[model samples]
Target: MVKNAYVHIPFCKSKCKYCSFVSYPQLELTKQYLEALQEEIKYFYKNEPLKTLYIGGGTPSVLEVSELADIIENFRFDKAAEITVELNPETLTKDYFKGLKSIGVNRISLGCQTFDDEILKSIGRRHNSEQVKNSVELAFSAGFENINLDFIYGLPSQTIEGFAEDLKTAAYLDVKHISLYGLKIEDGCFFYKNPPEKLPDSDTQADMYLKAIEILTGKGFEHYEVSNFAKPGFESRHNLNYWDNNSYYGFGIAAHGYVDGVRYSNYQDFDTYFKFPHVHFLTHRVTLKEQLEEEIFLGFRECKGINVQKINEKFSIDFEKKYSQILAKYTASNHIQKTPQGYKLSDEGILVSNVILADFL
Candidate 1:
């Protein structure tokens, strides 16, 4: 049974450049979208005991506080559920957050792309450095103890010193969580045509990433995942569910779901996503081979590598039997260790993880 769920609110005040996630400008469709979302929960979940509830979005805070509460109230969550909502810092207000607290949203993942005003507007973020600061203060004042601030490194025109400054400022805050992201430019956004000048070199980006991992780790924060850091006991439970290959119900346009060994998503277009009167979900069961592929891919995303013993035990197949040649290649090269507990990537292997995951595939 799926015990965790992710609800994607595909509504943004305006789209950000370099973003390809399925969300649209929600200027007038907020009410209708919430209704559709409620119908979605009612139709699919039938009210299970959700251990973790994540309300991610183009911008979830776009909804009125009351609308946000009504959306959150649709679920029956666990007593100590880790309920998180993604908020654009610009949309937050003091009153908006108090209602959010009352409605059981205990975690706020604020998108504070960069503390520098220059970088903020360049990336099309609505909030400036001060607004970002104020929104975090607003949430903290309203009794939100768990907050995750997101910032991107390796932006088109960002410098290493600028990136470090942003991290230092956030660290100075009493915030318990940080999510660092690397910028990826794609088609259909401002970056596609007018990609910024003097983008950070791959080597520089790697250096920046390593610097962040080192700095955050030394600051009493655990580098639990490639892009996430947390103080002790504050690591994200909802994301851990994904890395562990546990099942979850994914709702909204372009949101992905895994249930009963199946993986699928609804159509990406908003018109199609909202055309249905009631909740609509589509399922595509994974072939056993596909499931195994995903297990390897997702597990390696964490600092803790995959457990070979568990895979062999659960799948009832020898790792050597399935991929003897691949295992021989990496093991001989010292890219992996066939440990008693499991197979783990070597230090060199962690940096080239994409290449490692592709080896099994």
Candidate 2:
């Protein structure tokens, strides 16, 4: 029924060094871009009364409250809908949070990469640690109960201790959710061209990730997903929709969607996107084999891991027999462990997840 949707706001005041996402520092095109987005939504959106709508971007906070409200008004949401907006600390204010609340936004995900002021500058982030704290306070004051703080573990000049402190501070702020990611200097980011010094090694990053799990869980957060931890009832429903392999609509430049077993993405280039806003840049109908692989890959991302019974029934294959060798190898190594429902990756397994998941592909 496509009860979930993701809208991309491609404009940012400036680019972050480690970000390679399809975003631009072109606020001048905001009006035109929004118009194009509306056109696309009008053409494709079926108004299914979305259960979750996530507005993500180069920086969605760059837009005015009224503008963001206008975008929200276009969608028909369920009564209990989870509408999330990704914001930068520097661009938020108490009034801004109130405006978002008035327009039906129930969740706010703040980009607080680190608490170290020096590391913040090295990564080209516009806000500092204090701003992050202030923004969280303002959000809470504005009556937002579901707040998420994002942190990167392996940034330039970032240390394990510093990252642990960042997670602790987030917990102290009483946010509902936290997402941690290892830094990947992908192509198209500034770091790709001019690599920063003092970057942590892979092993260090792994340690930082484990440390985060320890700190957050100790604070009564559930490590529900590999990269996400949340208070009991505060997991991100929009993102959970993705990990569950459900269908959704994607709007705006570079946004990807999976609908009716077909995965599609919009154009990344501004010129191309504006010209063909209603047309998808690429579409691939998922094959059964690919779908099975995806189910395994995505399911394993969760802390609960894959349900072998469901997989066997859905695909009509013997889960153990088909991948007996792989399962035995990982199980013997204690990297993959069996659960009442099925199996999940151990902490060490997650460290080498790429290598493990690749074998399934």
Candidate 3:
């Protein structure tokens, strides 16, 4: 049964230089896009109660409070479902946050990529550090108690000391969730052609990560996932669906979904997607072998790693018989370990997780 849903709104006030996500600056499409989105959800939503709902992308809060309310009212959500909306700091208004809360949104994810003013300008984000502080206060003023603040590290000219200060300030911000992402020079992004200078070297970036981890965990945040930290019970339920390998419905250009062991994505090009305004999507199915491989990869991203028994039960495979050879190799190397009830990565395994995960794939 489908339990999670993601809606991508491909409109942003201004696109970031480092982002390669499917988003545009054409704000005029707001009305028609919302209508088209509503039609698509009406067609494929199954009207089933949902466990989680996430409104992401270009910048979900770019819409007016009324528009966001209209978009949310169209869905059939489960009681006490974890409903979330990603907000850019500049677009966060008190009325907007309250409107979202009134429509059952319980979580707000603010894309505060960094707290440094110079870095914010360099990244082309119009919002500054004070804007983030004010926006978060607006959310709390709207009675939003569950808030997530996202940040990035390893930026051009970033120092471990600077990021440490950010961490300390963030811990003092009274937020319950934090997501830390490393900057990557992605294709199609401006950074790919004009890469930033003085980006932390690989070794320095690793040290920055270690330092941030030390600070955050000390402030009582649990490092639940590789790049995410949360106070008790504040983990992102929408993302947990992916790590748990559960089914979710994704809508909008470039959005991807996994249903019934099949994975599919809507066309990436907005112009191409606009042609099929009302269609939920065209999709391709993933194989059982693919599922097993993905489970190993995404599962071990969590600190707990994989649950061998659970994998066996879901995919109907004997954990040992299926990969006795693979297991022997990694187990001997101490990359994987066997527990009383399951298998998981050792501490060293998590560090080189991609290497081990790629082998399984």
- Candidate 2 ranges beyond 4 A from true positions: none
Instruction: Give Cα distance to truth, residue 138, candidate 2, Å.
Output: 0.4
Q: What does the lDDT come to for candidate 2?
A: 0.93
Clashing pairs in 3: none
What C-alpha lDDT, on a 0 to 100 scale, does residue 267 get in candidate 1? Answer: 65
Against the true structure, candidate 2 reaches a TM-score of 0.99
Cα RMSD, model 2: 0.8
Task: Residues 157-222, candidate 3: write the lDDT tens digits.
Answer: 788999998888878988999998888879988888888888888778777777877899999999
- Candidate 3: regions farther than 4 A off: 280-282, 324-340, 346-348
Q: Per-residue CA lDDT of candidate 1, range 126-212, in tens?
A: 889998899889999999999999988888788888888788888888688999888888787878888788789877877778788
Worst 10 residues of 3 by lDDT: 272-281
lDDT of each: 0.81, 0.93, 0.83
